[model samples]
Target chain A: MNSTPNEQVPLADNSIIDLQEVSIFYSGKIAVDKVSFPIAKNKITSIIGPSGCGKSTLLRSLNRMNDFIPGVTVDGMVTYGGQNLHGSEVDPVEVRRCIGMVFQKPNPFPKSIYKNVAWGPGINGYKDSMDELVEQSLRQAALWEEVKDRLHESALSLSGGQQQRLCIARALAMAPDVLLMDEPCSALDPISTAHIEDLLFELKSRYTIVIVTHNMQQAARISDHTAFLETGKLIEFGVTDQIFTRPQNQRTEEYVTGRFG
Target chain B: MTTDTYQAVQASNINKRSTRWAEFLIQSGLGLCALVSIITTIAIIIILGKEGFSFFQHVSPAEFFLGTRWVPLLEPQSFGVLPLVWGTLLVTFGAAVIAIPIGLASAIYLSEYASDRVRSIVKPILELLAGIPTVVYGFFALTFITPLLKGIFPDIQVFNALSGAIVVGIMVLPMIATLSDNALSAVPQTLRQGAYALGATSYEVTTQVVVPAGLSGVMASFLLAISRAIGETMAVTLAAGATPNISLTFFESIQTMTAYIVQISLGDAPAGGIAYQTLFVVAGLLFVITLILNVLSQKILMRYQEVYD
Candidate 1:
């Protein structure tokens, strides 16, 4: 089943999700061309590329997030633990439950902080203590301490960074096995970005994390595995340290070394 | 070279002066345009107050408010506004019952489900409903809707509150649907994506996230549409049959406040007479009811306004 020509494809002990030669097209135009990479279980994988180079487009395909866009077409296969995500038998709603996403901007629902976390689990028919679930998810996203007292307050009242964390908590409440982030920290300040980076480092121990990031250093700082993409193609995929320090593809080296986008 | 610089500066100053003059002129013109509505409102208040206050002298406030009968021309005329108030309320309530579900469904369909092509084709047709004359709607209620109701309930009158209300509801449906659609569309796309990412089905997202986010706007639209229905004149007047009978039955002919004013004013009620005074008094009363509704709705809207940025 392994058809990629690259010999340096790093295989992990437990790969929870895999994109096998997946290409995405929006309205007959190719956004990501034949990009395949394995997202190892319980590890942070960061996809880095210049803007409009299809990093986000590729990341969105994992949970069938691109299905929301009209005229979007996905080629090849995205699989979660050997189950095809795009197969007719798989419901996108169920797929999204297993593989949740956090977007570029912090889009907390215009609701109370409590509702923001509880809504996901509540809608998905969580029969246990909703309050406990909400608090646990918030704590997991590193937001409970700051937001515990004002749980009923509007989520919009929180700061930009806090809102981003709340969004993460909202995603976590669904108890997803894998979390896909589309430049989640791109809209935050440097301090907020660092907090999220640290949170991601801690989160990888439990949930498989794949993030598309524009910041090269942030990717290097937090990600265990890094996938560098250029012009809709996967330039290189390897351990973060190796990709940053050594040379494989000239483009990946150039992109990581501050030489070229 | 210095003279050339001086000439350029002088020319620039002249251009600046003209620009300032143009700006001042345009600013004042815009200000005056805004003031037109304010001035008109003031004038209406003055006119209605003068005549409305005169009516109070002829009839005591307690009698006008508490009394249920509203006959101005008869010898034993009673001018209690309760019957008119009940009539207005009944028609408005009936209209709301018919309008809210249909309007919101159309709004949701237009906003969440419709493609660009479908939206383009459907939106103008809805707007066309708004453009149809209220008089035409009145005739529609009288000629078409009343007969249809007569079929359902054999006891229904030729001119009845139900028919008037149903037609008014149809008349205001465009407003509710259009404004509600705008409100729903105003909800950001990212929020919908965020909900979808949380494994919510399209139905859940529409009902929970997108709808709640745009709730204030939808509520505001509903309030505005209700106000329009309350203030509706011609349709209610023609279909409801201006008998001023204060019955609770929907099939019974009743007279709304607007209909009362029209009936009295058109019948050549002498100027400054008790009958003529009823017109201003009822108009003033109608004005107060709608103003309170608008104010309360605005306050609620402001309180729940969800700023997504």
Candidate 2:
């Protein structure tokens, strides 16, 4: 019974996965309503909106993190490469293996830095070169150079920025096809945010990126495409520059101009 | 206002405030009470230490520690401590064996697995167990547990270490669980969340992260429970027999240090006699043992600490 996602957005090619009229209900309360969108493959697609707009909910649904919460029911079909992700035959754990997530706050286990990166690969039964894989994952997350000397230290002993990068390394160790970032830099200072932005830019050439950001400026800065949502509804989706500078929808323009949230 | 004017006004306010002696008197009263407790403690130590030193004069320390035979009430009155000491240790260790696993698991269940609704209901019931009288537990052990064990092990003695240890175990189960549960729950939720995010299941998170993080406090609480079991008198006196022997068999009846005290007290020993002095000696031993354990636990807590940011 809530407002719907924006309708005039260009759908992702059939080459990528698509959502059709996806609705999420948590304990009889609507979280995301009839939201339909295609997550572009191999591009930095940023979901930019104010807080409590179901942006994180939509991101979590992509990886089925919502499954952890009780009393959450979904009504819609999410097809990844034409395979029904929500179907009974598909395990949510497998879906998560394919689609990795990085949360707003960095959560590193109370383990060594090496173990933190090695966890995902070990769980997935990567039988060889676990040390190399840990190093490689840290390198991929652009954290290896700083942490290579202290791989035995607890991951939590790192600075906030370092810990966030370690979390990215942990997720990257999973080697997922797609990465979902929920407000990755919302908790970071500018220099750290810049480091992550540069890392994401480097990553997008190989991995599909879907980032949720409260910072509209961050959306305009690093993203290729931007989708604006408000009050559990998508208001606009377009090229990042167009969404920020010359928005087609009135609500998008208002949000972009800081006139309304 | 200028800086000088501000200081003047603040100074006036401070001077205007009441200089009542009532606050000082109340504070001094509390300080006096604390001092009383300290002095009473010192007095107890002096009294016990004097008698314990007297025991050293009658019997060498080596004989007390190493000698096996304990015939303190016999004609020669052998004052060897090995039997009583072994009996005390056996009962304490046996009690710990019963207490550690069951108590730790209950703590984990209460802190981690149980919901608020379950906790609110279960904790009060567990607390009720703690309120049960030790003598009642002694009676239950003698009547109920002894028969149960005898049914299983047909050759087992009616009043045995097994019975006493089991009863003492049940008696302190509530304290162990409650203290350990508090310690475990005191570990921050962030650590747990971090563990879960690493793909650790709930069980792994509990055993690996939560328990290790709270180990020091848990150890302190464990030591405290051990001391409680050692200090327990009535239960072991009734359930475990008065026969003091340095034996390892669970089938034989054994007496504990506290039990020996009770046994001696029940006899008619005139004041100022060596027997009367012996009472202080036993109590002094018990007090020192508990104090050392408490201090050791505190030291352990200080050493192996877990700090969360």
Worst 10 residues of 2 chain B by lDDT: B192-201
| Model 2 Cα lDDT, one tens digit per residue, A1-261 | 011113354546522557778788889798888777777777778897778888888877776777666678787878886787778898766677778878888877667999878866676678988988888889999999999999999887998889999989988888878888989887898999999989998888678889999888888787777878887777887767778888899989988888866
TM-score of 2: 0.86
- Compared with the true structure, what per-residue lDDT tens digits does model 2 show for residues B117-167? 899998999899999889999999999999999999999987899999999
Error of 1 at B130 (Å): 0.3
CA RMSD of each candidate after superposition: 3.6, 5.0
DockQ of 2: 0.26
**What TM-score does model 1 achieve against the real structure?**
0.94
DockQ for each candidate?
0.87, 0.26
- Please, what are the lDDT tens digits per residue for candidate 1 over residues B111-197? 999998999999999999999989999999999999889889999988899998899999889888998998899898999999999
Which sections of candidate 2 miss by over 4 Å? A1-11, A14-17, A67-73, A77-91, B1-18, B267-270, B299-306
Give one digit per residue, the lDDT tens place, for model 1 in A20-85: 899889999999999888888888889998889999889888999888789999998988877889
